[model samples]
Target: MPQPAPAVQRSGGPIAPHLRRLLEFVEPGREDVCLDVARGRGPMPAALAPQVRHVTAVDAMPEPPARADTSGRMSTIEFGTGPVRITGDGGPDGDRPAAATTREDRVRHPIGPDRPTIKADATALPYRDNAFSLVTARFSLYTLGDPDDVLRELLRVCRPDGRVIIADLVRGNLAGPERDRIERLRDPDHPGTPSIARLTEMITSAGGSIRRLDVFTVERPIEPWLAGACDDAAADRIREALLDEVDGGPKTGAKPRVIGGELWFTQTWAHVAAEPIP
Candidate 1:
């Protein structure tokens, strides 16, 4: 059997810059308490600890074993020394069996113990109302039960002037060819991605006002990179299919080709500042 992918860390890649951007919006210098919802491996909390008075990292996934790979992309991404408080008990679910899961199951991002985490759902956070000055969710809303409900919960725990930051892939974020592959691989019952308009509605309904809206375009020619990671058989098939796409002629109702090139993914964010309804 092939080795599994290592747990993802906050250290780098397309997501790191955008995550930093959102954190800056919170103005760690001004926020008394920074709460990171679904703070996997505590990377973001670790980043915020020095500036914010306190960072409370919460997530449904349990803390992984000590060996879990939590290293960031680079050595220079400062893993701040401030205290991080986590608040969860359960661990993340293990990969499902082949019969039970798809190719996506093999792509796991393990977590580490840099900060506190909890085994609590986002829609029903354990914190009290108005508990934190800033709440953030990154690349996590897609898996939640009801994103609208989760947004409300974020608002519920936020101080009157606190902010709720949501970041995720917008609809049509992936390249056309890759999107088709993702649609096929994703669970049918998975919550559909929320578009920009849909996200605005969710926040407004949750009693928040949008402050900043930004869309990030992530273009990476990563198929070749990933092809190397797959098993020999899978890699051979992928290579052949890619060649077919490049040689485009006629399809005999077969698996279409996947041209390795600038594949696109979206990162849409909504920063909503919560205010008490007077």
Candidate 2:
């Protein structure tokens, strides 16, 4: 089985600050329907809800509930599947059990009082053509098995002239066998981290015209980075590899550095704002 994400760090909302800043490129407006693909609870939807008509946050995987309330002035819908029980005290979920969701299926999308969220795959979305005014995905492009196919789907669902914004760990140093080996160890699903140039070509080929590109780096601890890695061996292997890379004259692209005696890695991410042909 694939390993779970590293759990050694503090849990936070999914729409990271860097991602929120990327919003400037698209500059959402009122009367716009925004779809945040593969986006799990974060300030993104809540932030955009006021500016746009509605924001749909979709991700295939189920995530732990966010600690902070995402309830905006707009209506909300909390969606997922699991055992849902009502306490004797009347709560938001209800004073009654919902019979619509079968025991076998169990997967139920509960409607609530905030902006709606749904489960969906990036490549095969349930949305119709030209259904959204804006689409945003962060740190998802390079990890997919087939990024082009998913990118095309994102473009297809986007309205003509609508913007599709994506941010990912895109750097030239992330290429080559060494980087691939380390990434696969960290997350096997990670096919390859694409460079900015390569990502640009893919977006253009998928019928999108690039309008803006932003580059930034995030620093994080390697210990927490490997907490839920493929295995202890894989994690150890990656740590050793990173250490060796740092020891060597060429650090490659991983950008290993020591902070307060703890080892950290700098990841380069790129945000691209593009629009499909009208």
Candidate 2 colliding pairs, count: 4
lDDT of 2 by residue, 52-83 (tens): 78777665333336887741111221111112
For model 1, how does the per-residue alpha-carbon lDDT over 18-102 read when each residue is reduced to its tens digit? 3455565454553467777663433466666656677766654423358757511121212122111111111111111111111
Instruction: Return model 2's CA RMSD, one decimal.
Output: 13.6
Q: What CA RMSD would you report for each candidate?
A: 13.3, 13.6
Winning model by lDDT: 2
Query: Which stretches of model 1 miss by more than 4 angstroms?
Result: 1-16, 62-115, 172-183, 186-190, 223-278
Clashes by residue pair, model 1 = 7-109, 7-110, 62-90, 62-91, 86-116, 86-117, 87-118, 88-117, 88-118, 88-119
The per-candidate count of clashes, in order, stands at 10, 4
**What local lDDT does model 2 show for residue 208?**
88
Runs in model 2 deviating more than 4 A are: 1-16, 39-43, 61-116, 142-145, 173-175, 249-252
**Alpha carbon lDDT of each predicted model:** 0.49, 0.61
User: Distance (Å) between predicted and true CA of 48, model 1?
Assistant: 1.2
